[model samples]
Target: MSVWDELVGQEPVVQTLQRAVEDAASMTHAWLFTGPPGSGRSNAALSFAAALQCEEGGCGHCRSCTTARAGSHPDITVIRTDGLSIGTDVAREYVRKAALRPALGRRQVLVVEDADRLTDQAANALLKAVEEPSAYTVWMLCAPAMEDVIVTIRSRCRPVLLRTPSAEAIAGLLVERDGVEPELAGAMAAASQGHIGRARGLARDPQARERRRRILALPAGLGTLGDCLAAAQSIHEEAGERSAAIADAADERELDDLKQSWGVEERGRRPTGYAGSLSSLEKDQKRRRTRLTRDAIDGVLLDLLSFCRDVVVAQQAPRAALVNADVAESVRSAAGVWTVESTVARIDAIVEARESLTANAAPLLVLERMMMEFLPR
Candidate 1:
């Protein structure tokens, strides 16, 4: 299948990019792709990159198309970062690479997956490259929103906006691509609230689904102060556990690779730059751990916000469909105790918590404050 197939419910975006690929004058040196989380911003950028490199404008079968889609093309560099922020060093390296002529493909494609994560220095470094790119170079930057990117850099690039796919579209993709049962896919789609990656995770992993269920059930149990505190603690601990698991795996892999590269079985022999490499890796891991922890906390807050939103919806339109339909009874119970204003306040609290997390506030403290807001007066 063509690379565009993976972009669910983005037909307009696909058409625009396809036309650009076919017409040299329509294509620009720099592109900024903006969308909400799971709206396929990165996927759209990658697809466009593939099309630009493909002999037949993303004929899926071509070597250039396949390699670009797989992120192994000689001329396509896809930066999928796991760190909290993209540093100036990384941006400079990408810029250096972008200045080179195409090795194999028709154009040198540079796709930065999380442009929103770029620090000011990094953004400035990237801006210089985009401002004066080589004739055969193409830059594609992905961010959650236009505001996340600096105005000077964003204004120089062509903008492509992607919308969150509908639940029906998400469910259809799950059923078609993942072989998921229709009923389960539909439920996961509804629960994901338009997040494509989250829907796939909920559909594929029972543990993820159970965790979401527990998170959704938390609001119904927040009758007492103790219950609210306990809920906060549970979410905090879960985020810690998830972050730890990811960090552990990454640490092991990095150490293993270092050991192999140095030809040292144990800790005896040390190659040149070994200590520096290890130190740099550890520092990066620490940053990544922090980002992962905040991401987990933000995910819980999103789930909680959805639950509160469902309560508000239930109160306003009793027959309206709920995001957490499986927990309809708990949602209805919450709706009984919370008025529209109170529910909206609870949602505001959750949003505040999300912002605090983004600002690097302590996750536990932010969560605790948020949970207390949910406690019944």
Candidate 2:
């Protein structure tokens, strides 16, 4: 077995890192791994960190490799966020950790999984750490694109870009790793458009598959203005429910932890400044909820866009395979009715709505505009 086994369809990236592990001259103190969603950027970073610590250069069975991959390695620090941003405090804390020597491994490795979420102050704090690192320390930053990272930080790191894996590769992984039936695995791979996480989700979760079916049905149902508004409201409500499902329990637990830390009981008298701390925690939770909500809405937009792409393909090439092949009937119907230009315009509108959501635009309004524009012309 190899440490790179799980990193499917990224041979070029594997080769680059392997050479660095073998030859010191090819190694760099800082590395950047950039890829689209589900391209396995963080997995690559973790694998590289494991290889650097391994005596046999990432023998998959070694303790070092297993520990690193499981995120239990003493010398590896993974900086990821569930909140909206990584602030200066977190950045500085990791920087201080990064200065220490390897506890038991060959090198100290710090992997920043969401480099794009770093605020300006946080980025500045990291610049010095990446610019002049300890001889035995390495920094790996992962982001969606090279440009997503701040210029000053990325400039100091070696670049490795990962591409979307092919449907064949994704399907093979699903079958081999998760024991998904081969036929369902192939279908989920195509549906996910090389998004490995999404492919697995669709394969393992019947509800996710059902939710996708409903989202794909939207274009066909948008025949009137009321339909459009209703669709937008439905999408917004679903986003709220889904985000709340993920956040509600965690929010309550966090509040409980905070209260306990302040020595305040559920029905006890208030402690001094407890209100301020509670307010801060609530604000953070709200920000996280907002991020989760937008993420949920964006997933809907992406599904719609994928359906639009299939429509474009169907119109352009009548015999081509669609990404959403499970809904071939709908794809063909839409393709037969809508002109290529009209379909393309709606694709543009959905993409714009995704961007608007990322920019903190109102979800209902952005989605309403998007749904309205998607009406058949």
Specify the highest-lDDT model's number: 2
For model 2, give the RMSD to the true fold. 1.7
Among all windows of 10 consecutive residues in model 1, the one with the lowest summed lDDT is 262-271
The TM-score leader among the candidates is 2
Q: Tens digits of per-residue lDDT for model 2 on 48-127?
A: 99999999999988899889878899999999987998999899999999999999999999999999999999999999
Clashing pairs in model 1, backbone N/Cα/C closer than 3 A = none
Error of 1 at 142 (Å): 0.6
Candidate 1, which segments miss by more than 4 Å at Cα? 256-278
RMSD of each: 2.2, 1.7
Give the lDDT of residue 68 in candidate 1: 79
Write one digit per residue (lDDT tens) for candidate 1, span 259-349.
7887866848688888888898889889998888889988998889889988999999988899988888898988898889989999999
**Clashes within 3 Å, all models in order:** 0, 0
Q: Determine the backbone clash count of candidate 2.
A: 0
